[model samples]
Target: MKQGTGGKIINVASMLSFQGGIRVPSYTASKSGVMGITRLMANEWAKHGINANAIAPGYMATNNTAPIRADEARNRSIQERIPADRWGTPEDLAGPVVFLASQASNYVNGHTLAVDGGWLAR
Candidate 1:
């Protein structure tokens, strides 16, 4: 974006970015860093027409979460915590990702959009 063509920089953060999770200190720290740096980038690059932001997903059903999902108790507990009463699917992210990547979000910058199905809200 330094060349001024303008661009979008979408970084992936996590619910851990906003809160600490058990047994994942490194992951939590990194995700928090992602959020901080995304904002920093927006502050530095927005003037050049570069929009930097992040998306934080909560309790997603993905390969990486297979272990958690496999544990019936854990899965149930997680589901109960989310206001949506379910784990987030990859498809749930499509709209937010598209919005962040499109001109529709041209005025959006330095924001971390939580596609967490209201997990954070609770």
Candidate 2:
């Protein structure tokens, strides 16, 4: 940013950052740390024109979630919890990433953007 320009830093974190998740205590700790780091970076670098932010994805449909998605009971439970009524696709995160990396969010800083099919809403 010293070169007379601004930069955007987007972190792929998780909803666990906001809530205490089950079974995976370490995962929760690390991702929560990501938020702290993102905010710290934004605070220390904003003067240098750096915009740091994070994306907290909730219940995404991916290999990591294959076991849970495969279990009908668990799948139903998860989908029901999300306001969107479905597990989020990786594609669901695209728009938020674009917005954060573009001028659209130029004024946004140290924010944790949720791309969780509205799961946090519920």
Candidate 3:
């Protein structure tokens, strides 16, 4: 991007970026840092027409979350907490990712968009 004049930088953050998780102090802190650095990059790179943003996905039924999904009790607890009442799927992120990558989000920068199925709202 720097080699040219403009570009989009989409980073992947996590729900832990916005809140603390059990036994995950380091993970939470690091994801928070991802958000911070994304903002800083936006601040520093905007002049060059670079848009830096992040996506904070909630509980998803992916390889990374296999253990959680396997534990029926924990899975139920999480699903109940989310207004959507289910774990997010990788497919759920398609639209947001597309928007951020497209000119539709030209004015959006340095923001962490949550694809959490209303997890944060609850």
Q: What clash count goes with each model?
A: 0, 0, 0
Candidate 3, residue 99: the lDDT equals 95
**lDDT of the candidates, in the order given:** 0.93, 0.91, 0.93
Best by TM-score: 1
lDDT (10s digit) by residue, model 1, range 36-89: 999999999999999998999888999999999999998999999999998999
Tell me, what's the RMSD of every candidate?
0.9, 1.0, 1.1
Please give the distance, in angstroms, between residue 47's alpha carbon in candidate 3 and its true position after superposition.
0.6
TM-score of each: 0.96, 0.95, 0.95
Query: What would the per-residue lDDT of candidate 2 be over residues 33-120, giving only the tens digit for each residue?
Result: 9999999999998988899999999898899899999999989988999988888889988999999999989889999998888888
Instruction: Sort the predicted structures by lDDT, highest score first.
Output: 1, 3, 2
Which residues of candidate 1, in runs, are more than 4 Å off? none
Candidate 3, residues 43-83, lDDT tens digits: the string is: 99988899999999999889989998999999999899999
Question: Ten residues in a row with the worst lDDT in model 2?
Answer: 1-10
